[model samples]
Target: MAVQSPSLDDPRVLVDTPAAIVDAIPPYAPRSEREAEFYALGDGQMLLNIGPHHPATHGVLRIVLKIEGERIVDLDPVLGYLHRGVEKLAENADYHHSIAYTDPLEYVSSLFNELAPVMAFERLLDLRVPRRAEYLRVLSCELLRVSSHILFMGFMALDMGGLTPILYSFIERDEMVDMLAALTGQRMLFNYMRIGGVNGDLNHEFLSRLGDWMSRAGRQAEAISTLLNENEIFVKRTRGLGAISRGQALNLGLTGPNLRACGVPFDVRRAHPYSVYPELDFDVVTADEGDTYARYLVRVEEIKQSIRIIDQVLHEMPDGPVMARIPRRITPPPGRAWAAIESPRGQYGCYAMSDGTDQPYRFRIHDPSFVNLQALVPILPGCLIADTMAVNASLDPIMGGVDK
Candidate 1:
């Protein structure tokens, strides 16, 4: 009938008492099994609402945590605060203009977000992409991958209570953005990749900046790695926290750095080579320890791999037209096509169907954030409130992509 709530600051709650707590609190009626279970909390357990507005994702992600003092008992992740019906909007625009609609889905890695649809449309039209254009696509996507990962590293550390990492990360990330802006005409939502080819070629200003940045990019990355790889606070907070086993990663259907951190070599680029990735020389980085620390380390190594990829792309970039010769108005025969890319988050995919019209009959996307966010429900249970934040950042689910 009555109970005293446990204090997180007190040591008594950390250990089990002879009489365990159960079902001493009551509230609103159940909506679903998950909500019913959450509502039926053990004695002393209380529900904590994290946010309908949080920064880990660009827009909003709400998390309802059931906690007994400081330790999390279970959590319910709420999404869909930033969905803009991007796929529905694409169905109305012509092929050339439809690429613009995909830009905002994954704002941090906008180029790859645009590329999947472009490739899918290319498939629908049976268009042959230029050789040089393929290389440029790889180059831009790799750079975007690094930038996205850099933002992840900074914010992941920030979530774990490190301010310096974010500041240092932005300094390097801004330079890469400037280089991309030179090539793509704008910094954020590029809309550069066309159905057959890309919007532009490697220009003088972009190349000049790329060469300079390439010279020290490796060293800059090394410096940041050195800064975080062994810092006592960083290591202590993340080393064994929020660990995902190899089986868990696969069973949860995770991909990208999150899955790779669990030691599965299932990169969409390597597993199913598309674009110019087959031509590039780089190893698929993985870690045996699939914890929050491993996730962070995997992305750091990926930055190096991306840098190597960019260098090779620069040296081997061939001379040719970046845009394919296609009519301004695209009206493909009735057909359906699908294309998937290894986005910073995970496997970013798009499926398009054309019914002999300028616009797609149906356009749909599979954003990795949506799939990857499911892992949190399984992984966050025993974590402390602070550890939950760190784990969320380590997984790096962008609300823009997840909600879209």
Candidate 2:
């Protein structure tokens, strides 16, 4: 025979239940601290840990979400899993030698990373790059942007459960990588830019092959756009999901496509013209809807614009020295300067402090992805679990850029 435990409200029963009986009963603990706090604060919430290894977390990003049923009460992003003290490392490396380090900071757009540091060094040294070199840098950077976006398009499709686009996009990406390798002798980490100018020049045959490849790539991009852009499912999934208002985006310091998607035509290439961008004729694409779909559209349009820029650069490319006249052992007078470039992801800036030595006294990188990740906390709430991955993939925050 067993005795039933008295209810707590029943004052007649002193001992509510035996220890064994209590142990046998299910524990009455709150599901989570958030749930307990929700009840305490009268907010009625629970906590959910999204991912540190999720495919859509954009590489090791973890989010702590306080949810009231399906609605989010609060969002906390956990980062630092990929931090490698790159800024600290830059301080110790020579200004010219530091180009190798910046390449991996944003591995997806390594060329632009190299450009920022080299451009800053050029500015610090007051070096004038030849017209041909400037044109080459523009051509390479624009093509690199398209290549980076190609990877994004592929991976974003993969995240959305479509594998065919990945293979198709990679076909173009492989060609671009091959071209980059032909020029710089390395595929991904080109280390192509130096303090004063580029490491090499575009030969006649290489340019001709690139011209043919560009025509093919343009056709491929159109096919991709047709396949994904008009699909009803892709549109439905992306439209109005993770929408960020212009006010919210501006307040968060969002730039590049993220900001442009909010209908602000603020592109560093256009607004703050660097390299040969001022001479190039291209439209700054913007969309009224600041959602995942809008970001997708912006990147798609950007690839077309990059193609146009590359074509123009190729046609107008002149013959001259690729490297500016600078001492082999670069050691600028003690000074500090900032240089920003339109990277594939956004406006990437490099702030360097030189101590009149071969190495820098301090080196800091203003990675656009780090600031863009801040927008996640605000937009992530009120989105479904599946949409979380879509939103993250759409933002395209590179973890190496974020963590560094």
Candidate 3:
């Protein structure tokens, strides 16, 4: 039997040739000239682009990173992929109609986004909301917060290599969103909050389910905490990873769980009271460690706080009109008004300027995802490539809110 030598023309033989392989590959080029500045492929550093469409980014967020081995030496977040010109659209829409446009600013917690614009309109028009309306608003917003946080916890754990928590979180979140849908008619994007007040009142069925959810929320939280809180891998991955000090967090304009995790008791609900938050009894959940683990704990504890607030609202809810006595067409006096609240992510604020017209002269949003996302540039450096997902998950930025 003759043993034939491997042919040089063979695809396998060609791939094995070092010179042929090098010749086959082309030199890398920057996507744009502006992007050229991000390249620092000198010595041991190499340029890495994470995604405009990465699952770990949580949305359509792209991050350019310079890595030395597995450690990120520098990073720049590329934003605006999901921008929809929400502010410009709100400007042209009627004050009453503008509530609909604000819903997508923070797509996950649409109630909070809607709340900002409606609250601004109420202030802009100097409209007095009924006490019952205030109570209902608190109830709806807290429900939305819990729902958002539940899903956020799931995603965070999932990013950190735990799959069970995401499912457990969705279990709670689905029920919460179902209750919200019953009250608001929509699940994810709720345009339920009107200019003066909410579109409709919560019915007995919604309230009953809410009571049941409130009862089981503690047990569910405990179960989740038990599953992930002490897991050695989770603890090692998140503990002391991407730690942000109190000053750094505040300086970066971090809020909500991210800020609280840094030991700053700067809840917009407590520090800057809005709606019926002043009347509600709840403690600001905080932690000394501002790492990924601390952020997780802060959010879980916050779920309990939100439940407590909803309980208070239920007990003290007044019997009055759900909608304020405002005309069909809302035209605020020619002036500017700003309203902000503790959104699930952080401070979700809206600024509206009227020029004595039905449409707003100017409209702007101060989204927490946008602001808290800034903290990433600072926290990302010195963190390992594997830890990037964990750190970004801790921030929990939604591109809808970040880019809006």
TM-score of each candidate structure, all chains considered together: 0.91, 0.88, 0.90
What digit string (tens of lDDT, one per residue) describes model 3 on residues 20-108?
22432224866776456555356888667778888888889988777899989888788989999988887778876777887877788
Regions more than 4 Å wrong, model 2? 1-44
Question: lDDT for model 3, on a 0 to 1 scale?
Answer: 0.85
Model 3 lDDT, residue 368, Cα: 91
Record all residue pairs in model 1 with backbone atoms less than 3 Å apart, i.e. clashing: 22-43
Candidate 1 positional error at 211, Å: 0.7
Candidate 2, residues 1-404, lDDT tens digits: the string is 88987677886564656553343222576677754543332346656677778876768887766667777666667789899898888888777778888888898878899888888888778888888889888988888889888888878888888878888788888888888888888989999988767889986656776978966767777777787998888888999999999988899999999899998888988888888888889999999899999999999999999988888887898888988777778898889889998887788999988889899888889999999988877798788766767888888899989998
Identify the candidate with maximal TM-score.
1
Off-target runs (Cα >4 Å) in candidate 3 are 1-37
- Sorted by lDDT (best first), the order is 1, 3, 2
**What is the lDDT of every predicted structure here?**
0.86, 0.83, 0.85
Candidate 1: list runs displaced more than 4 Å.
Answer: 1-29, 55-58
lDDT of 2: 0.83
**lDDT-best of 1 and 3:** 1
